[model samples]
Target: MEFREAIKIALQSLWANKLRSVLTLLGVVIGVGSVIAVVTLVNGANVYVAEKIYRYGADVFTVSKQPRVISSYDEYRKFQKRKIIRLEDYQFVLEHCHRCQAVGALQSSTGKVVSGTHSTTDTDIRGWTASMPPMYNLNVILGRSFTPTEEEHNSHVAIIGTDIQDNVLGGNDPLGQEIRVDGVPYTVIGVGEKQGKSFGASQDNWVAVPITAYQRSYGTSKTITVYAKAGSTGEPLNAAVEEVRTLMRSERHNRPGEEDDFNLDTNDSFVGLWNQIAGGFEAVAVAIAGVSLVVGGIVIMNIMLVSVTERTREIGVRKALGAKRSDVMLQFLIESATLSLVGGVFGVIGGIGVAQGVTAALGFPSSLAVWSIFAGLFVATAVGLFFGVYPARKAAMLDPIVALRSEL
Candidate 1:
């Protein structure tokens, strides 16, 4: 028989027992769907992290007193004993680091903001130098950022985020109005554009003030995070980091061969951390999906074997009519593959719909990649071929005389 004829026969068999075919395909559907869903969700989260969490542009990094990833309680305690990064260190970097394009200092505290009866607690009060705005791409939608003189004089001027404007100021014209932050009054100089949530927390629930003013109000004991922008060259970022490290080590009086007492984190560092987390999730998902696929394949193999048994008379008739063994095997193989491919198509659709629904309901991100769909279909088809071999071979080896003698 021709290949097309075999395919038609296989499809006809499936259509004749539609319920059984559907039941057999369930495992494949579930397996493929799980894989696709996981990939889509992971891809979307990676994109979100890159765009929102790492929004400070690629060329910038921050210097802080402690490492973001502390391996143990002892390590955390050791880092806690390190000297806090200060505004003076930021200035030193600006003056001494030639590979740095810009350097800024930031200190933040949580407190209550009050404007008459309207007040909000747990509000982030960030103090930043002039260079912070440019380095962070902090666009002001209303009014303007603080002037150099204002920063130098420790002026009580502030830039409020959209949350502060809406919740405290009631969306009124906020510029030039005074809002008390922890009992200290600050005239509003600007309102920052709305920045969406990161890691399920709102980014807009904060206010920015000059570092000088913040130090005066909130005290200078708080550790300052220093942001540095590297020069526009491939080698400058590493060079700048190295230069800053050397300068910091020398300034802190760290003897040669002693470990530095600060952490330098770049955009890639955060991305790397996210990748590690995401990779673990992906691995677990894939493993679970693999189990489902194995179970589904077993179902297909058992069903195919039963199918061969039920259609013994038909196989015998074909053999009596001069059908070759290869032809019989090919027909069964085609039937198994077609069954799996159909399931794969449905699985892909279901996975995408599920991903979208999850994203909409939970506000989690999901992005379906084309390759994932194709890969899912391919895996399903491969499972069919791999599991169908034994059943197809057994059917092909049946004796025409005995098969015809046997009754279903």
Candidate 2:
């Protein structure tokens, strides 16, 4: 028999039991769709996190009391509750690290700011060093950054954010103007340009002041975040982190083989941490999808078994009319494969749609690779072929005369 005739027979058989075919396809549809959605969500989160980190600059690394990416709430709480990185450590890095372009410390607070008739509530205020402007890629729009003298002497000068300038100063020249921060007055010496968004929040809306001034005003502790920008492109960030670790370890008086008190964060480790989180989710998704495929395989096997029992007389008639056993096997196998391929296509479409929807809703981006889609389809077809073999062989091995005499 021609291959076309086998395909036609398979289609006819499937059409005769449309409800069973549709029911069987449901497993594939659900499995593929769920896998797509999970992978898409994970990919979106990865993109969002990677962009946020890149925005911080490739040459920069930060050091704090704990690792950059904490895996659990308990770990976060432990870091917050512990005192590891200190002002003395920041000063040590500032003085000793030569390969660094600049070292700066950051102290953050949220408070109210009042300017003339306008006021902002619950605003962000970052206190750092004069060197921070260059280290973090911060650019001045209309005025200069705080001078080193200002940071050293705890000067009352401040830099106003774009949002503060727009809403409070009415877009006028804000230089040398007084703004009350939590009722403490400070003179604005510069205005930062609009920085747009970072990690979903407006970066331009925050205020900046000298670390000393912030500490004096807010009663902030000596502890602050220390950031260092490496000098060379090929400079090893991990080595830099190690250098910082060594300096910190020596200062903190730790014995050899003892874990250092402070935490170091670099780009490579940060990305690895993100991958660790994403990898967990991917594993779960693969397992669930595998289960779905197994269920679909069982359904296919059951349907094929029923088909073999029903087509006994037809198989006998075909054999009597010169059809070979291999021909009979191929026809049944092709039918099962065709059903799985169709279901797989529908599942792929559904999965992609889900992925797109997740990306849109979560404010993250996702890219679907061609290999993933093709993989889903190929696996589905292969599953059908695998599950169809037993039934196909059973039908092919039947004696022609015995099959013809059997009751339908």
Choose the strongest candidate by TM-score: 1
Candidate 2 clashing pairs, residues 3+ apart or interchain: none
Error of 1 at 29 (Å): 2.4
Encode model 2's per-residue lDDT on 266-346: one tens digit a residue: 666787888997899798887989799879888988888888898899999999999889988888888888778777888
Residue lDDT tens for model 1, 366-391: 88899999999999999998999999
Instruction: Flag regions of model 1 displaced more than 4 Å.
Output: 1-22
Candidate No. with top lDDT: 1
Give the C-alpha miss distance for residue 349 in model 1, angstroms.
Answer: 2.5
Error of 2 at 363 (Å): 2.9
In model 2, the worst 10-residue window by lDDT is 358-367
